[model samples]
Target chain A: MSPLVEFRSVERTYPSRQGPLHVIRDVSFTIERGGILAVVGESGCGKTTTGKIAAGLVDPSRGTVLFDGENISGFKGPELSRFRRRVQLIHQDPYSSLNPVRTVYQTLAAPLKRFRLVKNRTELLHKVRELLLTVDLTPPDDYLYKYPHQLSGGQRQRVAVARALTVNPDFIIADESVSMVDVSIRSSLLNMLLRLNQELGVAFLFITHDLSVARYFSWRGKTAVMYLGRIVEYGPTPEVTRLSAHPYSRALVASLPVSDPRVARLRAQDDEVGSPDVPSIQNIPPGCAFHPRCPLYMAGSCDRDVPELMGMRESESLHQVACPVVLTR
Target chain B: MSIRSDSAPPASVDGATLMSVRDLSVVYRVGNRLVRALSNVSFDVMPGRALALIGESGSGKSTLGSALTRLLPRTAEITSGSITFNGKEGRVQLLDLSSEELRRFRWRDCAVVSQMAMNAFNPVMTIQDHFEDTAAAHGLRDKAKIHDKAYELMETVHLDAKRVLPSYPHQLSGGMRQRVLIALSLLLSPELVILDEPTTALDALSQRAIIKLLRRLRQQLGLTMIFISHDLSLAAELADDVATMYAGQIVEYTDVFSLFDKPKHPYSVGLIGAIPDLSADGASLVSIPGSPPDLVSLPSGCRFHPRCPLSDDKCERELPLLVETEPGQKVACFHWKDAQTLKGSDAFEGRNS
Candidate 1:
């Protein structure tokens, strides 16, 4: 079967007073049916923009996004509406993503009622309760009447997830969904998403800044490391996180503070990046965007030539990195 | 450093205690309800050492930070406690200080770098103006000296002082703004610095940069610090000692290595296990089952009993005191032995390995 969602050389830009701000450039990846693809990056690296484009919430300025072998931009009328229903976007802040005045039942039932998925009030109530149970809000009656304000942060987020599932979306764009939640409850939310992916066969395009979180949720899937609007590394999650080929990816993995102090100390002693400054999107560094901060940065070639993503080894390994210098080594 | 209870003797070993907090409790009034933010919290801040107060939201870590500087909101009240600071001048009671004396004590003796660096700065003021205002407030009349000191401090933080000093806070990135705040916090060269979730808002790379900057600052200045954060990894990275707070109480206090490797408190063990380790080989996370209890109406006896796996009738009836379980390790849980035994099992070893 074809992939659930595919992005072919997607590029998104916003017109700014400085110039056309390149928020996303030459980004391409695919999430198979029931597959997971985690896009890990910093705040300004356009990971959220990538998710928006994938969900059809924002149109890519260049290239195409295909949903189940059909071009998303070309869909019209019912097809577009169907695509919208099939793909859901979960925002980062559950506190603001949910309407304050709406109860859990009201929030979940609207999608079902608007989509005409339920015939009557009884059907709507039953479906909403089922959705809540799927998201693990037990004794659904207790939560059905609780307002967003009445629920805790974790419950509010779970409600957000249940609302996403109301349309029975084939694809879910979770944009740092668990980051705002408390640490102790973060894993439960991720576990819920993982279960949804496995049991329900729902694909996910998980966007997060946390490498560990990305690695954890998508352990069996693929990961794409974004830097300044480009995919610097794209490969199997374990391979990309454990044995990263790109200098940027290596730095990110190494710089991450481990729970163990000995490991954290050892990682700190590794070669530090040359610079910590990230250039503005409007004035992104030429050639390799990370060359300025890269420790193994070559003077001439790194500043002059734009590197493209290629396999690191001679064999047909799925792991790919966008640094020619590393590839040559 | 030796472990002791709240009623233990004054700092006699491992140098003098820089700040001693004894039986501190804070309450916040919302409507008619009085929310207990901190309950009999007591700890000593050692000079030139970094101590991390690690906890999740509503764990009273941030409230403790605010209470240290007496910066709590109008609704909040420090009902009982003694915050004594051993400064270069003499031993002073922070709680008893007059408003003018407290004003001098805040930036002159101790500085607090809050979590919200984005909103910390005055948007109307340039970076230079901020420095000038801070120095001027501390009674420094020489503008040139203030500018020179600011320039040197900004450079110390690895920012291009020539460009950054003139630029507004908006012109700089999140990381740069955070660095600016750190530099401003040190403008007075206070004896201690308290950073509350310093890197919580930044990206991973920027967070790393700030971490590196803080580590360097600690080493170069021999700075005494109380780092407040919910991230265990960060606590492991920067802190010499770790204090685990749960439901507005200190559940565990020990060195960073001991806390991560052989955590005694059940909550600390669960918290450490919950963190996703990049080095670990696909280990399943063990999240604590229930959410933190509301402060207004807390659980009976031990606050953590509701969520603790080791809770019993004794735990539900009697509150546990923070007492020394071993040399340099203090735990408030009655089932700390069980928690330690649980940590020795294969599951935790597999994840830690």
Candidate 2:
């Protein structure tokens, strides 16, 4: 079966005062039906732009995006509406994404009503309660009348998820969904998303800067590591996080602080990147965007040639990297 | 690590405490209700040690930081507490200091680097102007001398001083602004520095840079610090001692090694279990069952009892005080002995499993 969504050499650029800013370039990936693909990167790395492109919310300047084997740019009217309903985007900030004046029932029921998913008030109420229950907000009656201001951050996020599910979406783009919630409640939210994927067959494009979170959410799927708007590493989640081949991925994984003090103390001190500053998106370094900060950077090749994503020799599970220095070694 | 000439003496030499808090309780008046922001919170900061206050939002970690520096908001009142600081002159009670003395004590003795580095600086003023204004407030008016010191400190924090000192705050990136804030915090060379979520706003790579810089500063300067953060991994990376706060109380206080290796409080265990571990393959994460309680109307007995898995009638009826479970470890839970046997996953197994 064809993948649910595919990006063919996608490139997006936004006009700025200092010429055109290359937000994302040569980004290509696929999200299979009911499969999870997490895009991991730092700020201004174009992960959000990539998500918007996948959701049909933004147009790519240079490449084609295929949804269900059809080019998204050609979709129009009813077909575009259908695509929009099928692919939903959940934003990062629950506090701002939700309407403060709308109650939980109203927030979830609006989408259902507008999509003609429910006939009357009773059906709408029942559907809203079911949506809340599906997201694990138990005793849905207790939350139906509460406003966004009355709910906690976790509850607000769950309500946002329930609203996204009101239209019966086949794919969800969760953009940093769990980052704002408290750590004590973050795992439960991730577990809820996983449950939805397992029970309802919903695919996810989970975007996060946290490597550990991406690894946890997409353990059985794939991870794409983005640096300065390019995918430097792509592979199975565990391989990308634990045994990464690219210099950027390796440095990111190494620099993460382990929860155990003993392990943290024993962490190798050689993972330091050359510079602490990430170049502005408008002024990204030429060649490999990460070469200026890569620790294993070669002088001539790293500064002159841009490396393409290539498969690793030793990895059997389709692990690919974009660093020539590490690839040739 | 060669000690700098201006660095303070090693903390372990005399084993003297730098700052001590006794029964500190702060309450904020919200409309018609009195919200207890902090309750009987107490801890000690050694001269060279870094203590991490770990908790979620509304846990009063920030309030406690404000209380220590006597910078609490107008609505907040210190109902009961004493903050004692051992400085260059002698022992001084922070709460009893006059307004003028508190002004001197804040920057000269203790500096606070808050979480919002984006809003910490004046937008119109250059980085040099900020340094000049700060130094001028502390009676250091020599511009050339200040410029030289600022240049040295900026280099210490690994910034390009030539480009940064003349640029306004908006010209610098988030990471650069944060590093400048750290540099400014060290301008006075205060004995104690309080940082609230120093790296919470930066990206992962930038966070690593700040952590490494902080470690280097501690080694070279023997700086004493109390950092308020919600990230457990950061606590493990930077803290010498870890204090876990839950609903305005210290649920667990122990060395960093002990807190992560063998936590003795149920909340601490739950929090540790909730963090996703990258190194451990297929490790299941378990989140706590409920949200933090409302401060205005708290549950009876222990504040954490409502969400704790091991809570019993004894835990519901009477409040538990901080008691020594080990040589230096302290826990404020009635079932701490039972909590000792529970791993992070075991504590919240059925909830998320």
Candidate 3:
């Protein structure tokens, strides 16, 4: 069977005054049906752009975004609309992402009415409540009449999640969906994601900068580390975080503060995030974009040749690291 | 250089304080109905000390900050309570102050360094002019002296004086913008510096830089501060005392050492549980089950009762008061004693929900 989502050598770029800014590099990955894949990176690292492409919002500059082995890059009109039903994007800020003027009923009903998910007003109301219930926003009656601003940050986020489920989409690109919500409420949102993945078999491409949230709270998922618009590492969540192969991944994991002051003191300091500059889509250096800040970088090899995604000599698992440091480790 | 709470915790800050906020509440009439942005919330920021108002968004952290500085919208009515600032300005209730008086006291006596640095600075003007305007407005007629002072401040806050002085807000990076704003705040040397998520928008590098600079400034200048943020770990690093705020009320507050070492409140315990401990097995985070309460129509009893793991009938009936826990710490919880009992085994164990 074909994978739920496939990006075969996909590249994205945008036109700037100076030149074309290449936002995403030759990114190629596949997520199985009901799988969760996290794409972790810093600001301006093309993670958001990647999520946009997966959501069918934008066409790639160099490659195509395929759903179930069908290239959906050039899809339009009915095909696009159908793709929209199968693939939905939820944004970071629910308050801004949602229409403030519309009531929750309108917000959830639009998709139901458009997609014919329900039969009549009674059925539609039931469907809306079910969607809300799946996300743990119980007793939808309490929220359906309320405006977006009437809810708390966390409640709004849950409503956003509910909206994404309105179309019964098989796949979702949750673009930092919980980052703006209250930290106290973020976990409940994560729980909803886990339930959706388990109960509905919906695939998630969770994009976030918060390492802790990405650490399998939503669902046990494969993790990818992106740097300078390139996938630097990919593996199981446990290995990706606990046993980080790439220096960049290691740096990011170390960056998160711990409770104990002693262990926190002994932990390695992040060799700067290299100024969060991927040098734009057009100007990324020929070799490793992370060479400037890499702690274990060998000047000649790292700057002269970008290492291919190669696994450690002995590990059977697909834990690939794009760095020369692998030889030493 | 570091003050340890080990020997004996500091003296209990009595009701006789430097600044007193009495029955403070902020409510906005958003339609026909009234929305209580902040209920009967109250806290004090004594001289030469800091109070970390910790909470998630809509917990009235920023609303409380605005009330103290009197910078809320005109529609916002301070329904109750008086926040009296008794410093160099002497026995002045912040609510009673006229626009002109608030303006004089806004930055000179009480300056708020907001989260968004862009909004704080005038984009068209140079960084130097911002300091000059505040200085000039506060009756500093000597231009050369102010210029020198601005330059001195630039160095003090870890900004390159030459590169930052003439640059616009857009020219500097987000982190640099934050540092510039912080430097600008010190221009008048305000006695009370109220910061609202000062480092939220910044990257890790800039966050570290801004935090370090704030610590340095606090240590060197002896400025009493009320620092507000959602990130407890970041708050734990800077604040002397951490006050966990929820539903527009102080749920639990203790010195950073006690808060981190031995959190009395279950809400505080859940917060610490949520943070990913990178060093410890990178275990999963045990996040709180529900979100913050809606201030407009809060639950009958405890606002956090719904989310609290140890919540009981007492928690559901009577509103918890900000009562004293350990010395110098306070927690508004009915089951602090029982919560303390459950905390020993599972509180720190297993991060997974």
Best by TM-score: 2
Identify the CAPRI category of the predicted complex in candidate 3: acceptable
lDDT by residue for model 1 (A1-329), tens: 87889999999999999979999999999889999999999878999999999988899999999999999999899999999999999999999999999989899989898999999999899999999889878778989999998777888999999999999999999999999999878977887899999999999999999998999999999999999999999988989998888988988887776889877866745546776667888899999999998888999999888899998786465899999988988
Model 2 DockQ reads 0.75
Decreasing lDDT order of the candidates: 2, 1, 3
Give me the TM-scores of chain B across the candidates. 0.94, 0.94, 0.90
Colliding residue pairs in candidate 3: A21-A281, A22-A281, A22-A282, B284-B351, B285-B351, B286-B351
Docking class of 1: medium
lDDT of 2 at A317: 80
lDDT over C-alpha atoms for residue A29 of model 2 = 91
lDDT of 1 by residue, B123-213 (tens): 9899999999999888997999999999999999999999999999899998899999999999999999999999998877788889989
Cα deviation of A16, candidate 1, in Å: 1.2
Candidate 3 per-residue C-alpha lDDT over B1-353 given as tens digits, one digit per residue, 9 for 90 to 100: 11112211113324455677766778887776766777666566678887788888777888888888888888888777678787885778778888899889988888889988888888899887887788888888798898899889888977789988888887777877887788788888888898989888865545755666777788899988888898887776577777788877778877777787777788888777667655434344556765666666777788887777777798889777877876778888877876655443244332321
lDDT, candidate 1, equals 0.88
Q: Residues B1-353, candidate 2, lDDT per residue (tens digit)?
A: 11112212223222278888877888999898989889888778888999999999999999999999999999999887678898786888888999999999987899999899989999999999999999999999999999999999999999999999999998998889999999999999998989999999898889989998998999999999999999988999999999999999888899999998888898998888887876557577877877888888888888888778888898898888888888889998988878766674656654421
Residues A142-245 of candidate 3 have per-residue lDDT tens digits of 88899998887788888888898898889989999888877666765776687788888999999998776787543366888888788998887888888888
A-chain TM-score, model 2:
0.98
Instruction: Estimate candidate 3's alpha-carbon lDDT, on a 0 to 1 scale.
Output: 0.77
Model 2, stretches more than 4 Å misplaced? B1-15, B344-346, B349-353
Clashes of each: 0, 0, 6
Comparison by DockQ, 2 against 3, better one: 2
DockQ values of all predictions: 0.72, 0.75, 0.37
